[model samples]
Target: MQTIGLPGTAAPHARKPGLWGWLLLAPMVLWLLLFVVVPTGILAVYSFCQRDDLGRVVFSFTWDNYVRVFDPIYLNILGRSVAYAGLTTIICVAVGYPVGWYIARRPAGLRNLLLLLVMIPFWTSFLIRTYAWIAILKNEGLLNGLLLSAGAITAPLELLYTPVAVVIGLVYAYLPFMILPVYGSAEKVDNALVEAAHDLGAGPVRAFSEVIIPLTLPGIAAGVLLVFVPAIGMFAITDLMGGARVPMIGNVIQNQFFKARNWPFGAALGVVFTLMFVFTYLAVQWHGRRSQR
Candidate 1:
């Protein structure tokens, strides 16, 4: 009779960490301490402290900044940021998955070329690319010109400086991040597993659902986190394509430090944002462990 291991059972062939593993990880640990940990610690301290009119830290303890962050205006802005990021993540996944899959399945000689094509846009500056979008989507821009020439519409569609335009920019900027990770997973997938599923009478949809999806889930999760987290804090695209019409959480935090001169409030927002990323990372790890079981 075969025996099944309990959920919390240790791996039967687990090995202890070696000297090489510790050595390889030393740089990452130092980087986290110097850049991420130190900076976040400073931000947390400032958040619980006060800032004077000249934007100098006063070192006085206070909860006013955190309380103000929960005000209706800021909360609404946070909600909008989450919504925009969510939309961008969804779009990236939808657009990137097929491209990644195609690249992964290509002939070895052509795969590099296809992957290069995916990364070609990064040769140009991101800001420059975003500005190019401005020229294309503006009222009297290329899109309108083309439409007018074709007699498709009489007036300009007002495509630029709108939420839709911001979403477009976000999706364009982050699609590569989503594609690369998924491609990594798809490239490593064994074709025989898929063929075996087919041989066992599994339909195309069933094979994809039961086999491909599970195998590529790690890459999907990685891509989602990469796209969603950064999209939430992107201020440039929102300011440019969104016309600064609406305030997102990113804009609010930026405004606090610049226009409002409220360093404490900005620090508070940063702390909260950092904590959110930590929680999300933990949740993803937990979910992966559960799925493995």
Candidate 2:
């Protein structure tokens, strides 16, 4: 009689994807090639070319566009963008982690309701939501009125068109991105393992630190990836809230393409931005693998 493999022994080898599987993947692969790869190729080609006085792409090779990206003014903007994104990521983790954990630990019915509430903001148009923040942060807006009524201050604070307003908009928009991923990870943690740690004389803090955090790390990394990358490149939030006072790299890229009519420089900036995304992804993946090891 043939014996079944034990848990420690290797199981039967799985079959590779066949013709039907390839057929299923064909649409997605084609879509990626058309939308992602082709566009990136075009952008890279443009980045190496020049622009004429008439704002036309000149099919000639030059490294000036990339060199210009390293100019002091642009470098400062890049630094500022990184700083803002880093701050937003930190705030999201601090606030979202607890909320996600709480919701995940709740009763089934309540958990669904809380998740719905967290996701409701996405139902509305992003532009409309950002405009709503302008009304709240303006001098004569809801926030100032509330502060005045509460006798918090005599004069209205200049909250709008500032770094603080920009940060608030960023945090408000991206907090849900952080929360959902964390909730997904936190929900899967086996309660028995936590209990076992406690039974072994681990304190609440110790158990949570040593067990819960590690278990939820993948979600946190995913959340950071989701939040940090887009946050760095977001132009709308910074524009409406910051009123041109705080310009991120996204704003620079947009202006290069539209306002300045400098496609080559814009493409260079875009290529750099894409590289940053790749680096962030690889770093997150590396960290996750290290934690697993």
Candidate 3:
């Protein structure tokens, strides 16, 4: 006798998403299309178009804007931006990893308190915070006054309106981005695996290098991307802290739009800047996958 197959018992083919699923995703899809996709498309179109004397984007297309992007002056600015961003990423990784690790190893109550401290800066406006740094770093400011009073220096130090100040601002602003992701990764790390390494006669350094580093690589990658990307495009800090004397890529792009009245050139620079980020991220992901083998 042939056995009858039970109804709704056998595995069904994957069903097509119903109206409810689409409705749930509708808001996110609309948001991306409106804000991200549409803006990006506009930028791309503007990059190829010409700007009139008034900096209005003209309908006519031209390669002059893109050509200017490769000019020596802009190229130098781009290089400087990369150097600043790279240094910031390195410093963030060095400082944030330890802070994240320490926080993760703490008891839940203390861990939460430490995390809250990290987030406290976010409660205030970032612009206000940057301005506060200006007060502290300027000549004859609090830092210089303290040093002068203590006889640490014969004269007030000129710390504000310099490259050093720009780096400081970048590091301060992005450090939390690095810490949060690292903490998420570190908190999930298995203590048993670390203990096993110790039991197998591995030293702390060896275990950290061979096991912990590998485990937390994802967080490190994320933090680097977060810090590096924004740092490359940072304009306000460079302008406010670095005195707007030294030109960064962001400064150049901003000048093209507002100062020089060259909207097409600005758009071209922006397009190239965005593409660089996309390529860098893809390269990182490829390297990560290759290393996992």
| Alpha-carbon RMSD to native, per candidate | 3.7, 3.7, 5.9
Each candidate structure's TM-score, on Cα atoms with residue i matched to residue i, is 0.91, 0.95, 0.93
Whole-model Cα lDDT per candidate?
A: 0.90, 0.94, 0.91
lDDT of 1 by residue, 153-250 (tens): 99989889888899999999999999999999999888999999999999999999998988888889999999999999999998999899977888
| Candidate 1: Cα lDDT at 22 | 81
Evaluation by lDDT, superior candidate among 1 and 2: 2
- Compose the digit string of candidate 2's lDDT tens values, residues 1-293: 01334444343435567899889999999999999999999999999999999899999999999999999989999999999999999999999999999999999999999999999999999999999999999999999999999999899999999999999999999999999999999999889989999999999999999989998998899999999999999999999999987779999999999999999999999999999899989989998888776
- Clash counts per candidate, in order, are 0, 0, 0
Q: Which residue pairs clash in candidate 3?
A: none
Pairs with steric clashes in candidate 2: none
* Total clashes for model 2: 0
Better of 1 and 2 by TM-score: 2
Residue 127 of model 1: what lDDT? 93
Off by more than 4 A, model 3: 1-16
Ranking by TM-score: 2, 3, 1
Q: In model 1, where do residues sit more than 4 Å from their true spots?
A: 1-26
